[model samples]
Target: MTSQSVTPASAPASAEPKVNWTILLLGFAGMVIGQFMAILDIQIVASSLPQIQAGVGASADEISWIQTAYLIPEVVMIPLSGYLSRLWGTQKVFLLSCSGFILMSVAVGLSGSVEQMIFFRAVQGFVGGAMIPTVFAVAFTAFPPAQRVTASVIMGLIVTLAPTIGPTLGGHLTEQMSWRWLFFINVPPGMLVLFLVSRYANFDKGDPSLSKGFDWFGLVLMATFLMSLQFVLEEGAKNDWFADDEILLLSVVTLVTGPLFIWRTLTYYNPIVELRAFANRNFFVGVVMTFTVGLALFGGTFLLPLFLGRVRGYSAAEVGTTMVVSGLAMFATGPFAGRLVRLVDPRVLMFGGFMMCAWGMWDAHAVTDQWGFWEFAGVQALRGVGVMIAMIASQQVTMSTLPPHMVKNASGLVNLFRNVGGAVGLALLNTSLTTNTALHMSELTQNIQNTNAGMQGMLAAMQERFADSVDPAGAAMKAINGMLLKQATTLAFGDAFAMLAIGCAFAAFVTLLAKPVKQQPGAPPVASDAH
Candidate 1:
């Protein structure tokens, strides 16, 4: 295999480039596994919370942290993935990451305490983070530009499957089995990915031609900033926002470290992310879209499972089953949608995607305690189609414009937005959830008459459960508390759906801002690399 070099645009008009589907599929397998492992872990855990709480005897705070710990590192590690992929070859780093992730998953399964489990989960996310951008970088590189849309489609399908399948699988494990299986299940697939990647993908000492120097300061500071920000977002809702000293500390670190990180990259010749890559108008615009996409995509994904379980009284497995069709829909649609972008302009497709997402949110907003399950399945399936259109199209557009050399850094920043959007959206939506829940509960609890049929029914049940030992006042308070919790959950889901719709609208506005694809090949790009 001779190394072919091009100046970094589309393949040179004169160069008859070859496509390698075999290598690309091999790489995709690794990525699909990694994505499935990391995200499925999240969804599975969401449904298994009740079982986990029971088995570990974990407190609510501990349970929340179990999720938060994994989430923070998941986003933070995304930016680092590019740097690490470059420092280590993309294939090398990806394989090592899968290996590390599997080990961590095993450890998480073995964890006996809440603290230990959260710690191991975070470690798992940290390793799993490398899978995406590195996978895309490799996919885009190995497969010719003609096949990029196809690769993007496959990528979207595989990535979305984790969240789509996770809930049902999680529900089954938690209900029929134990929550620990959610983490343990990754072990088999992870091993397979690790083995196949090692056998199939080859990594040359990456760009060994580069000077041994890079701006170490920028990398360290940036990681600190992103990691800090992730911590704040993940913990902020439970920590009472600005009131907690830990949040304040993390805020100060993020505020201070972020600027310093930017300055270091700008001032130094070598930076962790080639700061120049962001200089591409198309790439920068892509990153912006990713940020918003992350917010809505991950935000909605996180909120739904939680709301269904907490507010609507759906068992984890039941809720998970509703979303199972979603993965299938995405898998079915991703490649075709990617190819469709070639025929239709991306902006039109992207705008359509956002509109579809908004429509789905509107559909989702109508969820109720008594809502039928199929309605949700339809909502999720429709949402999955919309996400595919936007994601695959944007990836094609973003990759089309950058110099091949800059793809890794650009991919990293793009992945970062994907993660941060989810984390920040989680914080924002959860905040809304907490506040709205309170107000809804207050409004619903008004004018409660002790003799009212509903009240009488609840109080009577409470009285019987406690027998004559139950104080009338205590039983009434308990019933009211349960009612308030139920009402609040309903209100919170409504707020989340509304917020997602608005956010998708904003995403549509931003999509219109993307510049047309330059389609230049074999020429150095004008934008500065983000390194």
Candidate 2:
């Protein structure tokens, strides 16, 4: 079936048959803005960790829960959106979700203590998660079928840039104002969108499938599996891995809940995610790419700042500033990619982007203790450019490959894999890093064969420097140990990047199987006839 198309001037005012293009654009813009708020929080809180920790007297674990709470709501809500939007009109869902997000964000900002903040932030996640998936459904359905490629590109750019800009905006706000302003920032933009959403979106045309009640069994199983998985990743090191009871409990939860959730989703008449979407070759492969990309996305978002802060001694603002180069590069490449997607097949772009990202990660892995700031920044820029090319084209290819009616299903499926990927990526990276530390330390110790006086004196100096932390004589011994610890961290980070590089490369290889989409007459690779 041909994609739906809307025209404003030809329609009778009474039909309100379709929103005027101008009104629609405003709605689309609002959707993009709403999405920005959710993605930004992913790392903005990390940049403000110190300020937040001090303000609320929070421990690292407590601060973590603040993020976890927000994430849990979003994760649980995202996959259900396709079904939810169908049940409620799209505009109603979008407006409601946006409103809820802004309100919860306000509540989070005003919270008096850690408990208050965490509770509200979790609420915020529910709204925010709904916000993102709906944006995809809205954008995909609003444009004509022929324009999906172009629309996807515009959206691809925004999704890429919004998260990228989060750190820059968060840095400026956190440094210039209170941490609350980071959240307070969402209000004005959101208000504008709420108005625009009322004017243009055909909430009346929402999907008809959501008449079913809540799928409690599916919800419980999925929530248990994902939430428990996230807990294992974030707290694994502190909890001492499988030996810890909590980890063991989480494993049991995953083992029992994950398969049950999938089974129910497949069997249900109106599954929240429409599990059958995976039947499409393009959509299925896209999910795989989504997972790998998600991992890189979340892993890098977590690792870079931590690396700079812990290893290189950079402040939050400094790290945020440095990370901006990657975003900027992606912004610059987006328009070019939109145009390129039409002329070049998405497979070419996806493959190239994967290779480039891998190369960039390999570059990042090369960082040394003495490396200058510019070195790190340079590598990030390359990664940023690579990200735009990979994500933008992949988005188009994934959706374009589907029939018009299946677009929403495809988007939901894509979202689910990416979120899962992000969770798993962090856990996998953390494990690899932990393991690498031990191996590297052993190797480093083996290389110290020179028992010369100069080396001995330097080791002695190192020993004296660490004396207070260990014992007097133990200082020298522990000094070597401390140096080894730092080196291990370095090696671990390098290994993580290298693995990401390899994984991204494999993702690109899978994407290469996507057949070239025959261009529709007058179709551009990336066009957004946004009102």
Candidate 3:
């Protein structure tokens, strides 16, 4: 299906308008807060799920839905937000979303049962999800090009830093207070955002007339397609992918609805999403770069904590504390990256960023069972700095190159790519870890025979250590098997890191292919082509 180009009702302002820096900055800051809260919620409950599960009296299997419920609806709302924001103006949509999110946060915190928790969490996700892309749209449209670099830096920091620190903050909050504090924490800040944005964010007016030809059927198709696809990705690894009945069903649903949604979107008079922005080559490449960034960003965050908890047996707080090194590195590097993007070619910065990510992942590829905070510190720092730099450059290229009217729609699409990339990366990495660990176990068992001299000596040593036991030989054998399993799992982790390293290295090379973007103080965006 071919997409038609969308023409804006009005062009960009020819001259700079009188600016109110204080009000504008305050409103923008509020929007950033809303964005941070939304993104942070995605990962905050991850480490503390067990507490939530116990509190709600949910089974182990049912407990996962606490997160799945939130994610499915959140993904559905992200792309749809472009249409909503256009129909109801940024200020109104943002205020509504913020208000709904705050109320849902309270409902989720007060939920006493599993069912109640899931229902409220889904509502929270839908509202909170809108805040994310809306900020991206505002950053480009609200700020003049001269100040865009600084704006991008603040955004890059929030986008990366929130998820990076989510587990740490959640673990501490849950430990000191209770799991409910996780949701309640958003209250004060959310209210502040609501007040500030309502007062000062007058970026654009709503086109209520656009509501006339609104495609309700197209909206259904999109929601179904995105929700089904997100469900499949989130649950696929746990259920053994297509082998599970529910996974198979959702996969089919996603396949059927995805094309139908695209066809409807392309053919509709006023489509819900704007696919024409993709016709611009720079935006397309920029989206691809952001996709890779999501893969590394979310993938690394998921992998390291699992490693620490499963292999190293670190407590939640300990794992969180150890992970803070990366967040700190990102915080320290934000200003430098912001300044650097203005001086150097953005493509160059992206290349360097991806390379740094590769170096970090490769360093982790050599991980051992004894590896701890100090061991992972350098690796985490590299990943933190790399993701921040690449993200800032990618964000600039993706949105800055689009025409002013298209930025809203394009922002949603770009953010969606990064999220989907992270989902895909997690599924693939999970599958790889499981398969490789079993393969390594099988190989190790065959290589060490009972008759081998080394095996005999190790068994004898274990037997001597367990001499007081009633069945010393049996205990020795069990200990040997446990050691073998630990070694096998450790090897599998190294393999996972190796996969990430290889992926990042390839992405680094791909970064060079993107066209260079240059921002002028008072001029419109300069793109290679925009129809």
Candidate 4:
């Protein structure tokens, strides 16, 4: 069937419908802003968690729940959003999500206890998560073919840029004002988005009839499975994986419910999420690309700040400053990447982008405690540009070939994959850092001996430096151990980066498996059927 045949009659007239650009663009812009705020909240507290913990009287361990609580509900909501929007109408869902998010943001900001904070954050995340996939769906379906590249660019920039700059912005806000400002900051922009979108967003009407046989059980199963899986991924490393009782219990829940959820989704008359989207080969490959992009995007962002804070003794503000280079690089490269996507084969762009990311990660393998802003500038820039490029191309590959009716469901699945990839990447990287550091420390300790000249020289120098102390020898031994730990940690970071480099390089080769997309003069890029 032709693309137009599958589109609902009540939906927009065509995939590239001839509509008033002014109103659509305004509404779309507002949606994009809403999405930015939603995503920014994900990591905005990353640099200011300690301050938040102090304000809420939370312990070191309880403070982490601020982020984890948000993420768990967010992950569950993302895929369900497609059905939600279809059942409730895009404009209505968007408006409700925007309003609820704003309210929760306020509640979170006013929260006096860690319990209150966690509850507010979870509600905020559930509502805010709806905005993300909705924006992606609107970007591909609302715009004409000619504007899709530009739309992709805007979406790509926001998706990657928000998380990249979140920590930086959060640090500045906390340092200049207070940690509460992180949540309160969403208010002004959010209000503007709510106004613009309410007046201008008029794309699709919901069919309440679709709710007739809505599988409520399936919804419960999906939520249970996703929430359990997310909890496992988020807390697994910190709790030492399945060893912790709570973690092992959740792991069993995830294992049991995951397959059952999938089976129910496939067998039910109406599934909460569209699993059939994976049947499309092009979409499948694109999903894989986006997954890898997530791995690099979140992985790189996670690694740099960690190394800076732990290894370099940088404060939150200092870490933010050093990491802002990547954000700037992404902002600079976005428009150019947008323009280039239309001219080059998307696969080519994907390949080049992945290669650049790989190169950046490879260069980072030389990281030391002395490395700072200037040291990371080139590496961050490469990653910034590479991720932006790869993201745009991956978006095209995922959505360009799908029928207009399938776009909404496919968009949810596409976003879900990326987030899952990020969760997995973070878990693996955290495990690597911990395990590798211990391994390296053990080896270094074994190699350093009293008989070794180098060890003797270092110990003698340390003893001389502490000559005024009564226990100079003991101080020297402690100093030497600290030095070894630092060196081992640094080596572990290098190994993580190297592992990321290899993954990106592998993704570059996988790009070749995707069908080449060719753009016609006034038509959308079509996926070749040759494969």
Candidate 5:
């Protein structure tokens, strides 16, 4: 069945039909389930990596590939999804991707070797990646323009919260059951989404004739650039950037292919990706803002869990619970935020969102081993407000200005930018944390001289406190050293938060540059139109 296309702004006033809530709800449900599964898959595996390594007999280096395998293909295929959907149909592609993702999850769970797992993971990434952009594309068409902001708010929450919650679920399952359950757990949700989609989804069938003009050169270049870049970013922190030959090689490949891909995109007729989306003023600024949203979202998600699990001695379940407050805060404020998007200048929301994030991250600067749920929950709540405001506002402002015809390809671009930001931001945070830890440790160690009376006295006191230990001196020294490292890591995390705050500030300021989109006042709310 061919999907209905949205009515462009230029359409006659009487051309629109009344809103159809039933189809819209069904579509929204399917999209949320599909999108949630796609996002949660990544973080779930991340949390359960150690257990997975033991199950698959993977070494440290081999374990890294499990994530890399999924990420590279996921990033590479995201932009291409638009073209694929256009060649077939959105509903057809979405259903196909869901089936592939479920089957791949089963394969990954059953695989006896690392090689098999990686292969299946890459396939899963390629298939699942398309679902994200497709669902995003559909959101605009599924809801009327009047209710678009509300729909976006709900979508943004699912997008932002899934990864945050995935770790907690993964932790619970891995600790209580086999690691393979991580994959098996998708079965029930997947089945339900598949049923909803098959029963409710009907999009316009795309013109297969357009497939003949597909830009093969552009596709190859785009794929190469994305894959190489993903490898470089994911492995760079681990390999110490260009110091490693493998990283250096991939960096060179990325540097060369990235420009070629851009050139091909701009020059080719009917390019795989619609590069023209960048030319729109609001879209350009919105893409920049979206980047910050990704950086803050992904970066904070990484930092909070790392700090809790490693420094504060929180288990996976505990970390997940701590982060859940952010999700709850977003849910509580979502409808209000949506209403604000409709009434106020979205730029105001954008600025407020970033400021809220800055406030939360800065507040978290004082975190120590003694800090617990009460401390983190409050800070997360503030940041969750930032997430809802910034994400929903940015999404609405970005796509609203574009003509309806551009939304499909532009949807892919939107998700592409966010993923790129998350990947790059994560790499930066990881590298900074490692380097700052060493610097702080070195500076702190200088104060622990044996010649200092204060240092010696502190050591003696520590030894006395732990008198039960066989080697009191060694035990005291070890305890002192551990405390020092923890303090250093805490400082490093604080520094990361500061950097994120600075970035958010810049994104907020950039929002001022975007011109407001003028919607026709008193336009009747209508269901998304069929082509």
Candidate 6:
């Protein structure tokens, strides 16, 4: 059967660029699989860090660089995608990225040393990062305005649900198979997508000769800024922030280089990145919304595994199973969210999504040490609903308003904020977890004095239980302190959840600031009247 042709949204229908829907579907297949690989890889590694570290005999400090190395290049490449796409064509850049990603994945899997693993992972990140924004460009350019919502819904599911389900899937893989399988797992799908992309995708063509005028200085500044910023966030918690000379220096570098990169991008004729996408009111609001989405997504994602694995003594796979409810929720609501965008103001969807997420975070706020999988299922599911709604709405709210020519740059910007937000949010939340746990520990320890009758009774009870030990009193105190520490940490987890709830609630209010897009029945989207 011949493929159905789609007209580019930017052009008049009579003079529209003809694109085959069969080819488009094939291309989208490539995009979706690519995105899933990129997002899922992050979570999979997170779920099985201990095994991975031991497999390579990496120290705890050294193991962190595995993640950090990936993130730095990933963030740096994200903003540069627009320029690269225009310079090398989306197809070539994407194809090159996929090819590089697959090779790096293979190398990473085969790596027997920490050095090799970090090197390959960083290269993988550089290539893999470009795949994400390229998918968005294809969606906007390949589909007409009428079908953009449908495209957004699909992107929304991949964006929101992949990380949600990553731990569960990663846990299962690590428990049932080798840690190397985590990297190897991307091979089949990545290869299939690679084939589909090379065979079917042809739009967004570029001239490689344009690289001659590329802003090398701006590139240097942006890379330094992103790398330094990533180092600060990733190492900040372990290094105790400014107390570490390395982190302090990186922070200073980030502060100095960030503005210069922005200044260069804004002033240069042929910049490495385009920052003007933020000038659009709708895109600006969308960036804010995307940032919050990332913050909540990553913060909540990190918190659950910590709570389940540490506090409840659950295995990685079990934690993943517990979190799968959120994934299921996203899958269920994603179609509805896609349909809703075409019928109502997108801001409404954003509001509903943010509020739902807030509700989930608030519901899970009072988490206790004794809480089980079922206790969190409802709250996790609620988060799924929120993410689906907000993600889909924000995609429409942001992308639909921008001219088709600007979609690529806009996508790069949107994903950039999402990533940066995740990094910053996870850092802040982790810091809070450590700080609050310590503070709570201090308070709880002070109340354990034997002056109180209850404390005396507990101590006596513990002593009796350990009467056969060499130092029963010391043993009893040790056991009590361990229990207190666990309790303190659980309370700290609760505090983190509560803070996320407040953040989501604030994001919900921020939804009102978005320029709403209303599509009347059988009519195109109407421009915003909101100031």
The best candidate by lDDT is 4
If both were scored by lDDT, which would come out higher, candidate 4 or candidate 5? 4
Model 6, residue 392: C-alpha shift (Å): 0.5
**Model 1 lDDT on a 0 to 1 scale:** 0.75
Worst 10 residues of 4 by lDDT: 522-531
| Candidates 1 and 6 compared by lDDT, better number | 6
Residue-level lDDT of model 6, residues 202-295, one tens digit each, is 7668968868878889989999999899888878997899999999999999999999988998999887777787888888899999999999
Comparing 2 with 4 on lDDT, the higher-scoring candidate is 4
RMSD of each: 5.7, 4.2, 6.1, 4.7, 4.1, 4.0
Best by TM-score: 6
TM-score of each: 0.88, 0.89, 0.93, 0.94, 0.93, 0.94
The runs of at least 3 residues in candidate 3 whose Cα sits more than 4 Å from the true structure, single-residue gaps closed, are: 1-14, 464-471, 521-531
Model 5: residues >4 Å from true position, as ranges? 1-13, 462-472, 520-531
Candidate 3 weakest ten by summed lDDT: 1-10
Q: Candidate 3, clashing residue pairs?
A: none
lDDT scores in order: 0.75, 0.74, 0.88, 0.89, 0.83, 0.85
Q: Which stretches of candidate 6 lie over 4 Å from their true place?
A: 1-19, 518-531
* Rank list by TM-score: 6, 4, 3, 5, 2, 1
Model 2 has a clash total of 5
**Tens digits of per-residue lDDT for model 2, 34-54:** 777777776667777777878
* Two-way TM-score contest, 2 vs 5, winner: 5
Estimate, for each residue in 302-373, the C-alpha lDDT of model 4 and write its tens digit.
899889878898878888998899999999999888877877899999999999999999999998878899
State how far residue 47 of model 3 sits from its true place (Å). 1.9
Local lDDT at 219 for model 2: 71
* Model 4 per-residue lDDT at 220: 86
- Tell me how candidate 4 scores on lDDT: 0.89
User: In terms of lDDT, which candidate is stronger, 1 or 4?
Assistant: 4
lDDT tens readout by residue for model 3, 1-531: 001123233633544555677888999999999999998998888788888988999998889888888888988788989988999999999999999999999999999999999999999999888999999898888887767778889999998999889989988899999999999999999999999999988788889988998999999999999999888888898889989999999899999999999899889999889989998888998999999998999889889988998899887788889889999999999988987776788888888999999899999988999999999999999999999999998887777778988999999998898888888888888888899889989989998864788889999999999999999999999999998888899899999998998888898888887887866655323231121
